[model samples]
Target: MNITKYVLVLLVMPFLFGCNSDDYQYPDKYLPNYNFSIDIDMSLPLYTPLQFTANPVYIDQAGIGINGIIVMNTGGGYVAYEASCPNQNLDSCSKLAVDGIMAICPCDEAEYNLFNGQAEGKEYPLKPYRIQVTSGTSIRVYN
Candidate 1:
């Protein structure tokens, strides 16, 4: 094609399809507002299970988010997600319960992979927080 036509196409292509857009943006309710990190002690009972799909720790001590945070060790890495369901309206049944390697929304059975916090069979993924390894056996999950 022509040089000018090629240049115009290249410039307009990026805008037509967002080159750096994030395809997995969740709604506001699924995210948390508190800007704080909670230090987890692996020596604790709830956190002792570091397996792939084990019991998740309901850490209410963080004093943030809807209910609190649920930390799960994904075998390779650790992920911390908001305890409440991100897709459903805030309700008593919106709390997510851990079953195997997924976080299940009690209201609609919307499951999310705890490893990457991606909601299974849903458009939006689970709301995720930042996790920093503090030590050999400790990590801090922050909003």
Candidate 2:
């Protein structure tokens, strides 16, 4: 019985730990970093419609460092994505347009889901920023 137990232990040990390979692979960086801040006042006509699953709003103000930023209400919470193409460099044609839940890039016609920033049929996703509700009347988007 002891010999049988030892053989069982030896079999289990390899399966328990397996191989420890430190080498791992990751995808390459494909987007530029642009600093920006956006303040949403719900009382403002421009942002009033953003409650949940509504049309996304494109914000263009002095403090938004790049061309602009896109803000949307995902029906659960708020999400914001950089209004630029992740697969391509910044250019006039690379700016994104929102149609329903997707952000479309004019240059390549690549589409990314606004809720999670995952591109459709592509490995690269949209560059995302951080957003939080400051109050019942306001939201802040920053990177």
Candidate 3:
């Protein structure tokens, strides 16, 4: 009975302590969630820039993301983030513009790294979407 109790406590202890309260989660107060799926072909002329590392593109297609979606090639792989500023309310100025390896929000000049979607000196990170490399020449971004 003592050995069986020890085994049960070992199994139950991990489940009770596994959850970390400090885990960072992007807040949804500012940018509302939208369901969208978009695919890009690297062979296409418009998306040819994505073939290179650190090159970011802003797709302004309507109803895709809150404002749009920013896709970038991080050399080793691809990452996609929402194009709106995570720290600000959704406004015309909340749209982020691609500048070099970072995306700059015109509202307050909050720059976010496109590679990892982290904001410069800010607690909130740019909301990221799920990306899948469909093939050698194609990628899909969805949320």
Candidate 4:
């Protein structure tokens, strides 16, 4: 009886704690796959109060396996994020709207802090992309 119990425990331990690829699935189309630099004009005001849109001003960072957007924060800082919603894996609703210092998802109302990409109401945070600012004019974003 003791040996049978030990065997059962050993067999179940892997399933309970071991890493499994099945438990994780990357986003199909929304996966970031680009890395490039873009020159942002900081002379004009790009963001409105409590609202920002990346389509008009900023440019997409492109590469072999990464896609991301670079935005000039309302407070004159820059922030970049993976174009996928952390709560839901939908591509259409993945864009985040700036609300003060938080990035709010229009889908499930999940809010992420732009400063650190931490979700405001939930435990899961937004997946952050790598950002490098050079000479205070250009920003390079990567996966």
Candidate 5:
């Protein structure tokens, strides 16, 4: 009986932990180029008192690679993050809503601090981009 049990374990172990030779390859066609920039009009303010909305705005004349970007103003300064959700990597249901001092995603309720881009409820934070604000009429977002 012990010998039969040993044989059964041996047979099941390999099948349970089998290895595949096919290397995991991410489709290159779907991956967008990482480096890019966009220009957002600074005149339009989405939120009030705190002054600016967490929702992403589409800027057509910014540049290639980055047609639309999310701009967040946390009162202290402006923060920019990728429009894509970190949890599911989907662009459709991902958006930032100002909750006190943090940004909350409506889809999964994944919250992030707009001040630092730190995820509140989940481990993974929202992907942040580089923001350059001038004293003029526009802000530049880069990744």
Candidate 6:
């Protein structure tokens, strides 16, 4: 019975200690959660720029996202990110502006790559949204 108990403990010890508790914490910890779903029609005049590669559009409609959503056409596919800077709370300068394929935070000048939402030497990456290509001319972004 003692030998069996030892074997059981050995098996469970790895299960308990092998997992990293910090894994539960997300990289984008500063941004608050918001529930929203928005669809963009690529054929529309406002969204027509997204049909080309590296053309990013900022949809600043109220309640669309934390600040808003920055939708980009990477040529490979459509990518959407929360326009709020990930490294800090939402502020006047937290809104990201499209600078080519990079989103620049006006406050800190932190640049995040639109292709992957990563900022160089920054701990947090831009918050991403789920993108569904409903058709050749439409996409749904949700979070």
Backbone clashes in each candidate structure, one number apiece?
0, 0, 0, 10, 2, 0
Candidate 1 Cα outliers beyond 4 Å, as residue runs: 1-26, 29-32, 51-55
CA shift at 102, candidate 1, in angstroms? Answer: 1.9
State the lDDT at 50 in candidate 6. Answer: 88
Clashing pairs in 2: none
How do the predictions measure up, each by TM-score?
0.72, 0.73, 0.83, 0.50, 0.50, 0.81
lDDT of 6 by residue, 1-143 (tens): 99999999999998888877534444546788789999899999999998899998999999998889999888899899999889987778888988888999888899999999999998888888878999999999987
Q: In what order do the candidates fall by TM-score, top score first?
A: 3, 6, 2, 1, 5, 4
Better of 5 and 6 by TM-score: 6
Tell me the tens digit of each residue's lDDT in model 4 across 51-129. 3423223244354223245354434455666545666665677666666556677888887766667775764566555
Which candidate would rank higher by lDDT, 1 or 6? 6
lDDT of each: 0.75, 0.77, 0.89, 0.54, 0.57, 0.88
Residue 124 error for model 2, in Å?
A: 1.6
| Regions of model 3 farther than 4 Å from truth | 1-25
lDDT of 2 by residue, 30-110 (tens): 555667677789788989878657568888676573557888888888887777777877777977888887889999988
Q: Tell me the lDDT of model 4 at 2.
A: 100
What pairs collide in candidate 1?
none
Question: Regarding lDDT, does 5 or 6 come out ahead?
Answer: 6
- Report lDDT (Cα) of residue 42, candidate 4: 48
Which candidate achieves the best TM-score against the true structure? 3
For model 1, the local distance difference test gives 0.75
Report the lDDT tens digits of candidate 3 across residue range 30-87: 9888899998998999899899998888898987898899999998999999989998
